[model samples]
Target: MFKTRIILTAVILLALVGVLLANMVQRMAHLHQSDAEYLRLFKEVVAITKQSYVEQVDDKKLMTGAINGMLAALDPHSSYMPATSYDEMKVHMAGAFGGLGIQLGTKDGNLMVEAPIEDTPAFRAGILAGDHIWSIDGKPTKGVPINDCVSRMRGTPGTSVTLGILREGSKEPLSFKLVRAIIKTKSVKAKLLEPGYAYLGISEFQERTGEDFERALKTLAADNGGPLKGLVLDLRYNPGGLLDQAIRVTNSFVGEGLNDGLIVSTKGRSAGSEREMTANIGDKQPHYPIVVLINGASASASEIVAGALQDHKRAVIMGTQSFGKGSVQSVITLRNGDGLKLTTARYYTPSGRSIQAKGITPDITVEFAKKPAQPEKKKMPEIREQDLDGHMQQVGAPKDAPAASEPSAAPMDPKEQELLGKDNQLARALDLLKGVNLLKAGLK
Candidate 1:
């Protein structure tokens, strides 16, 4: 009888605690009319699923799916990262990661490639800018989350991943079976295009990009035998990376005198979100004519660099409009090692121009096009006796004219093939730089 009384007392206490939790949930739900209705609906669905579902589903999986759905509805950039996904993100931010090396985003409910990192599997596979990813490994990508696509594409190095791509001009989707590899990005690449003209390609801005860019400039100067007369800063296919690196890149061009001038600014709801970034006075690059190359693939930090340099009159912008991704994502880690990449702020150019949907417009627009192969010249109608004006007796059977010699095609180095690859954009940038230099000399 005593044992039975003890069990009854424990049951009574448990019933009281359950009653208290139910009251708290009711009060929270009543905070707003819509909240109350939604909470009711949420409970109904969960109760129904638990009682009548085909198979038993774990509560944790159900809660995780709910959270993912909620965040997905917010924006394309905001999402909940599972523990594994969060770990991969940490690796990416650390500047080295394994994957196909293509930066992609969701566009029109489909996956689209923003840009492919240089020297990576994607780049080596001839994946050009503006290619739409229709599917991955035979799975359709329509309405798929960007994070899901990223997670699926990235895996162990040397593993094969097939992508169904719909190129801009192609009539049908093309399939590419690519082997993923560890992508080690060389953020800054520089070489002299000519005696005094330099070409610098910034693939992406990272923690080390600022210093790497400085080193590249010095190397270019040494190659040119002096300070570079002009530079073609190629941010064409660069998908922006770090915020600090963007400011540093802009500073490299703008130099020391106006270190206090605004480079870029951020505004958010939080107290500390509003801030202006500026350049620092250190190892400033020489004042030289700069032509910045951009394209639809350039975005975020890349836009910051372009906008800052343009506003300061430091570089002449060229190429098509950028991929307008002006928002900033702050990664917040949760207690369970998961993370939330939330869009906490929007980026503005130095002139207060919002870069959200309206990307940086180039001062000069240069559309990319492949140069058509030259057609072979037809041999002039053989000089016939009837057509000859003054028909003189042919001294002897004219020896067959030697077959026209064709120009020998030489193999181009990777750098040359990249910069001048059938596109007129880079060529135009170089011409603009030369024009600037000529005008400066004329003024002198």
Candidate 2:
């Protein structure tokens, strides 16, 4: 009986202290003062109110609200995550967890798929990466948190879920029925392109991106079983995930020694004091010419790889401009399982080129303009950033940029995106790799 009474007393005391401390902190923002005895009385009243309040109140929720409100008052990006949210975040960073295998994000109140993982139910059912998600089953996912929506999409394998998909130019959303499955996303995919050339595609940079990429390269080399000719690294729709992965990708082509430096840096807190990540050249070194393909949708970690290769002149970059997401984000976890993913630093290439707003420019720019297609008479939705290019949020670039300036960016009157869509850049990159192979062979 005494132990139970002691436990109850401790909880009550903690509640009183929390209430008192919160009130005290509020006064710091303004001008209020209090002393001991009356302060104790105020805390006592607070405890009584909390214990006997007519309506139930979640103390934990109230505490979280206070913390979030405090941080949000400072800046737009600064926010808090709760415990439930923290676990969901693990899936994003690690890139494996229960999911529908479709990468969904919002750009203007519309839920859109950045891309779909290969071989997942979503991908198998003919769901394209750029397909927009209108609803889960029949309920609208609009205004829902991305994490919460993702959680709703995930369940045990073999569980079926209905999705309403909206693609560009479709007036009505399409119905897609998918069974939840364990999607083992392969960060790297490689195959021999012709006899001497190899083609590699990185879907997303993860902890194992380098390992997977290296494994693919080795596989290609074994299949060739001869002096390699060239290589093509394809980072088309990869949104990018980790920094270490980017470094490894760059190192693969740069080779050991000869300081064909493949990194970019920026002005730091001190002169020449910027964080420098040098290329760790590969032993195999590709043993031939190299090419890298990047589109306007490649971003962050992807940009890092492309930028490094371009800087070192290790690979010829052939494609349109890249997605200018040069800022580096850091996820800071809280006491509660939630975390704050904030842009901690702005990244630059080893050549000191800042990718912020201005993405990596290709060495040989291959502009992809839309081609004419079958005329559709449907009235299209108002053109927006998302409509122009999926995952290519080229904000902070040169201002006064005209809408539909790049023909490949959108499907306008008299033209469709066959001129711009579906590994168009990758195909061109493969052609570049083949050319390199032919040139090397000619030299021999």
Candidate 3:
């Protein structure tokens, strides 16, 4: 009887395994069929375009346009890059490139100057934030795609590009001639706010950003005669860069004492794309009060650092809301030296909050008090992720919720000797840091 029972159980287990294998095979076959159908449809479309188009379209151009359209339909960050553009991107990551030194974007079908890097051609030429690019050279830029505008601006060093800009109070478009050069920016700048208080400004993250930040902090400590009582990290107008540099910067502040503490996590379709970056105990700065300054231009890697510090309760975030750009784009190089900048993942803060369309709100809101003589009726507002042409919506985000908005920064006074002296936001951040230090001393 025992031997008969064992034979029946074995038969049952084998039958169950066979059923599971059959289902797996069926699923794989269905996926293969779907892929084949998609390819057939795509080929049909290409064939029709090749035969019916008015001009003799080159096969290479058709393929490139199709790839670009596919990625553009996915999200704004996803893009197809040619060989030259891919080379330029590599130069940008290495922290040097020849161009106007300005970040570009599109707003309501018009080219907009997102922010001008300090001490660059655009900045020196007096290209203010929120300026509408009316024309590039003599051609109207009314509906030009952003990538095309970028290509027009970048050229060999010592070449010049002309821009027709429309400012807020200008009665007509103004033209400025800018000469391009290899712009090499120092990512980190530091100074002593006062004895025991330091001010550090990160213009952008680059290859050596982490190393530069550590060296800046050490120099500030030596200048202050001891460890810092408080520090203000300024990320205003900082367009973000490499993800590894963002991680390195965050690790400097919050990772040392906290073991396996979450900094950020990414979710994507592939198992390999999902990742969680954590901080480990290592060489960390002292437990001093930190205040992070952000504005509408802070984005990408900048948002990562700010979100992580805010989530970990390691710093007080102050200023206007940041530029919402929480998607991660991975540059995948093709066999022909071209590349595809594809949006592979969405980043989440340590507290599991996705700041894709909704940026980091300041813990304390501080606005600079400056009124323009004539504010443009249709002012270019802060460009967030939602403003992009095909930005990805956050996963599980509310469909009916309105797009997030950022407080517009007061127009800067160009003639002012020291803008920081009149910056209300910076003043408030400094005061907060000072108050925290005072509280700690009193408690002791």
Candidate 4:
């Protein structure tokens, strides 16, 4: 009873002191004043925390935690990022990063895969973006904060880490032992798939993505050595990065592939002068046909290309609904080595489709899975003010309106619906390409 009373007294004293200190801080901020009492209270708390706490705590961590808490109250996307997190953010915005080559984020404070980079260990290990990381080496992660869990997940090269994952439709949590390797994210992949289709996989719209794609195309052209068949641009699971890179990709399809097409043009100041860049400068429009593959994971920059192609009648877009992220975020480094990613603009397609919440509807629609039903929630694109400078305004969709809030005519047609489903969409695209090819060969 005596001990309990003592503890209660201490708590009461602490609360009183905290209230007093808080009032002082507020008054000081308002009056632009300082006092010895404020300093004394702050120092006293620091000393008490260091000397009397039950467990050791980092001062820097405590300060940062306070900052993060303050920022989090403002919005979900706005928060304090430490130096390490800031660096990773830079790498991601730049469209590449070195690590295990997996994209990860927090869901309910537990680490989950956003997606694994193609051919990386996480991909090889079959770690999917939506898989929940339940534990690290059998250590329970429930209720664990994401940052601490990530630290345990990442380690030196050649080191093995065990992950306990819970995938959708799994009977029980599965365990996988994976070795961490140095991952330099490669944004573009190209290959010859069928006789008439050259397949390309693009992970994101990173800074170097366009250059990487051109090189991939060169290799494809050199290998074919004959008349071009059709080009398949696979932009599944691509969270957009750079705006210019997206434009460059669209330009590649418009001018030099196989037929004549329109190049995307922007009109805003600082968005700058319009130039018609071609595949070969004067090759007219591409002579061959094109098919674009997109999915719910495809976002921002990817949508720009897809929307532009569809608007210009340059390529038949295929796959599921894309991520509706039409907004652009420009990362500005702060004085503390952290980054501030702020929304910039809203982008529009040549036909003026707002890719915000309403992603670009493919000319053809195909679900990712063979038989997809409604209720499987796919990621919606993040459209910002940064995404809409050049593209045409929606038929009636407002240029400055928030995503999906603008008025629309009756929903788009059936042909567009087919162009946006998953597998069926790709097959229909092949049919379109073959027709283009036959026409080019005078075989139509």
Q: Over 4 Å off in model 4, which ranges?
A: 1-80, 93-182, 255-286, 367-422, 439-444
> What's the alpha carbon RMSD for model 4?
17.1
lDDT of 1 by residue, 7-44 (tens): 99999999999999999998777777788789999989
Find the candidate with the highest TM-score and give its number: 3
Q: Which stretches of candidate 2 lie over 4 Å from their true place?
A: 1-85, 98-149, 152-182, 258-273, 369-372, 376-424, 440-444
Better of 2 and 3 by lDDT: 3
Query: How well is each residue in 1-444 modelled by candidate 2, as lDDT tens digits?
Result: 999999999999999999999988887644533455556776686677679989887877656676677566643335677667667656655756655688777889878898887778888888886787879979998888887788889988888999998888778879988989886667787766566666788988876788888777778878878655667778877888888878877776664775665464433343444466776554746446666777778887888888776666666777777877776656787565578765455677656666666677777777654444877466544322133222223333232111000001111222222322444665576556656555555676
Residue 194 of model 4 has an lDDT of 52
Q: What is the C-alpha local distance difference test score of each model?
A: 0.78, 0.68, 0.81, 0.66
> Candidate 1 lDDT (Cα, whole model)?
0.78
Which is superior by TM-score, 1 or 4? 1
Model 2 C-alpha lDDT versus the unseen true structure: 0.68
TM-score of candidate 3 on Cα atoms, chains taken together: 0.71
- Model 4 residue 141 CA deviation (Å) reads 8.5
**In model 3, where do residues sit more than 4 Å from their true spots?**
1-27, 97-183, 258-261, 375-380, 387-390, 393-417
In candidate 2, position 409 carries an lDDT of 13
lDDT of 3 by residue, 1-444 (tens): 999999999999999999999999999999999999999999998899889999898999999988988888888888999998898778767877788888788789888988998889999999988899988888888877787887788788899999999899999889999999888757899987666777899989888888899899999999878888888899988889898888888998787545547888899887788899987677788878788899889998998998888877788788888888889989999999999898889888877878887788877767655556687466567787778887877663411111110011123334321645667777676667767666666676
| TM-score list, all predictions | 0.65, 0.59, 0.71, 0.56
